[model samples]
Target: MSKKEKFEELLKRLQEISEQLESEDLGLDKAVKLYEEGIKLSKLCHQKLEAAELKINELKSDVTAK
Candidate 1:
């Protein structure tokens, strides 16, 4: 799959994690596990976005230089 597809999948999982975290009756251990997973997903998403942004900026600069 492409980076965009992977990023979209990660974003969807992050939203799922958020919903799970917000549940009223979740067990402490399960919540903690989900929270850790969510943190990993969040970091991955941030990295993906930062990489995409840098690539876009580089493309813009290249176009300007041409």
Candidate 2:
């Protein structure tokens, strides 16, 4: 899958988790599990953004050197 697709999928999952957490009927065990999963997903998204930013910077530098 493309980077864009992966990012979109992660974002969708995060939103779903957010909605699930907001529900008043959720059990503690399930809520805790969702929170943990959300945290991991958040970290993954952050890492992906950082990597993309670094790549963009490198490309810009290369262009400026030409």
Candidate 3:
């Protein structure tokens, strides 16, 4: 998948995790596992955003250099 698609999928999963974590029906073990997964996904999303920001900055610099 493209970075954007991957990011979107991760974000959607994170939202689902959030909803699951909010539920009283969730067992403690499962909740902890979901929270861990969510943290990893959150880091990935941040990395993707940082990479995109860097790319945009590079493009802007190139345009100004011409």
Candidate 4:
């Protein structure tokens, strides 16, 4: 999948996990597992955003240099 699609999918999964985590019926073990997955996804999303930001900055710099 493309970067944007992967990011969106990760974000969607994070949202689903957030909703699941909010439920009162979730068991502790499962909640912990979901929380762990959420953390990983969150880091990935952060990395994607950072990479995009860097790319945008580089593009702007190139335009300014010309």
Tell me, by lDDT, which candidate is best.
2
Who is ahead in lDDT, 1 or 3?
1
lDDT tens digits by residue: candidate 1, 1-66:
335457778889999999999999999999999999999989888877666643333333556666
Cα lDDT of model 4 by residue, 1-66, tens digit: 226557778889999999999999999999999999999999988877776743333333556666
The number of residue pairs in model 1 that clash at the backbone is 0
TM-score of 1: 0.70
Q: Which one wins on TM-score?
A: 2
Q: Which tens-of-lDDT digit does each residue in 1-66 have in candidate 3?
A: 335457768889999999999999999999999999999989988877776743333334556657
Among all windows of ten consecutive residues in candidate 1, which has the lowest summed lDDT?
A: 53-62
TM-score, per-candidate, Cα-based = 0.70, 0.72, 0.71, 0.71
Alpha carbon lDDT at 60, candidate 3: 40
Q: Write the per-residue lDDT of candidate 2 for residues 1-66, one digit (tens) a residue.
A: 326558889999999999999999999999999999999999989888777743333333556666
Q: CA RMSD for every model?
A: 6.6, 6.7, 6.5, 6.7
Candidates 3 and 4, the one with greater lDDT: 4
Shift in Å, residue 61, candidate 4:
27
Candidate 1 vs candidate 4: the TM-score winner is 4
In candidate 1, list every pair of residues with a backbone clash: none
Which stretches of candidate 1 lie above 4 Å from their native place?
1-5, 53-66
Which order, best to worst by TM-score?
2, 4, 3, 1
**lDDT for model 1:** 0.83
